[model samples]
Target: MSSDPRIRLSGVEHTFEGRSGRVQALDRIDLTIEPGEFVSVVGASGCGKTTLLRLIAGFVHASTGTVEVDGECGVVFQRPSLYPWLSVAGNVEFGLKMRRVPRKERRETARRYLDLVGLGEFADAAPYELSGGMQQRCQIARVLATEPPTVLMDEPFGALDALTRENLQAELRRIAKERTVLFVTHSVEEAVLLSTRVLVMSPRPGKIVLDLPIETDPAQDLDTLRTSPAVLAATEKVRDHVQRRTPLRQA
Candidate 1:
């Protein structure tokens, strides 16, 4: 990883004004993401992981402090979010088109990334014609075609079945190897599988309680790593932190 920070959050907070009153979603978030590093955020539901992603993507304003991303970013959401009518190549070229990339260069770049994700053959097919996993591959290719220095993924594989999700996770690991990746996920194993560092957040007024480093080769196969003791140990540590931070309900 490069020494330079690609994304930095300093005392960041997010709050919503609800009818019930003020709801604090995140509090005092201080983080730095180095270039070409992969980081995952794991926490209980409604703990503001998605909100953090949005803040980084500039979709939502931070309630306090700074959320800064120094490079261009491409985002992949939980859903494929492709244009159903467009062909796979067209979908991948969408961002480039918006940026006013020349037609021939856009096509070449889209095709290159589609091939990278093993979707070159599907270039002429509509997104609806592909399987769920394939659609996500297309989505990833679309994001990569833009050649962003950073990628922000919000539960991109969360909707897939276990087998498919695992496959995509492997693919994501490969794609994120040279880019700064900030992923939001609830799955402990997912965090273990992809992250170089995992940040665990406390629920409701979420704040980072632990930032655990994961020492493993990103080139390892996901399925093989699934049963590895090191991966299991890291997962257990994250799970324990989450369970410990969860508050018990009053009777």
Candidate 2:
């Protein structure tokens, strides 16, 4: 792990107008993610998991505190967002093109990332032609094509069926191995399967209530890893904290 952090949040707070009055989504959110580390945030709904990602992505300003990001960021939203009119490679190439990369080099680089995501053959396919899983993978390749050192993912596989979600989880585990990843997910298994560390947040007006370190070699078989005693213990701990913070819902 690098001594320096790739992303840092200091006393971070965020609030915005809701149907009612201002809703305070996050409070005193102090966190640091080092280079090449996979960090996941898990919380109940309305706990500001998306708000946290927004803070880092600069989609909205924090009502208070500061978020510092060292390098460019690539984001994968809960809903797959791809250019329907563009082919797979065109979508991937779009990012580099925005950075003003040469046309020839952009296509080559986009193809490389497409290949990395196992979508090389579908480079010319339209987004609608692919399955939901394939489209999400294409979205990922598009992000990777931009070569962002820090990636913020807001439930990249949340909509997929269990089998497809699990499959993409494995794929993401592979692709995110060397990147600085901050993922917001509601699934404990997903968090355990992918993150080096998992932070459990309180209910709405969220803040880190528990930070659990996952112990398993990234190269280990995921099934075996999931069944590992360490993982169960950590999951139990995280779930316990979440349960304590959660009652019947009050948004």
Highest lDDT model number: 1
Instruction: Estimate, for each residue in 1-251, the C-alpha lDDT of model 1 and write its tens digit.
Output: 44779999999999999899999999888899899889999989988899999999999999999988887899999999999889999999999999999999999999999988999999999888999999999999999999899999999988889888877887788877789999999899999889999988888888888888898866678878889899999999889887766532211
Q: Model 2 reaches what TM-score against the true structure?
A: 0.94
TM-scores of all predicted structures: 0.94, 0.94
Q: Write model 2 residue lDDT over 87-142, tens digit each, in one string.
A: 99999999899889999999999989898888999999999999999999999999
Query: In candidate 2, how many Å is residue 139 off?
Result: 0.2
| Collision count of model 1 | 0
Q: What's the distance in Å from true for residue 210, model 1? A: 0.8
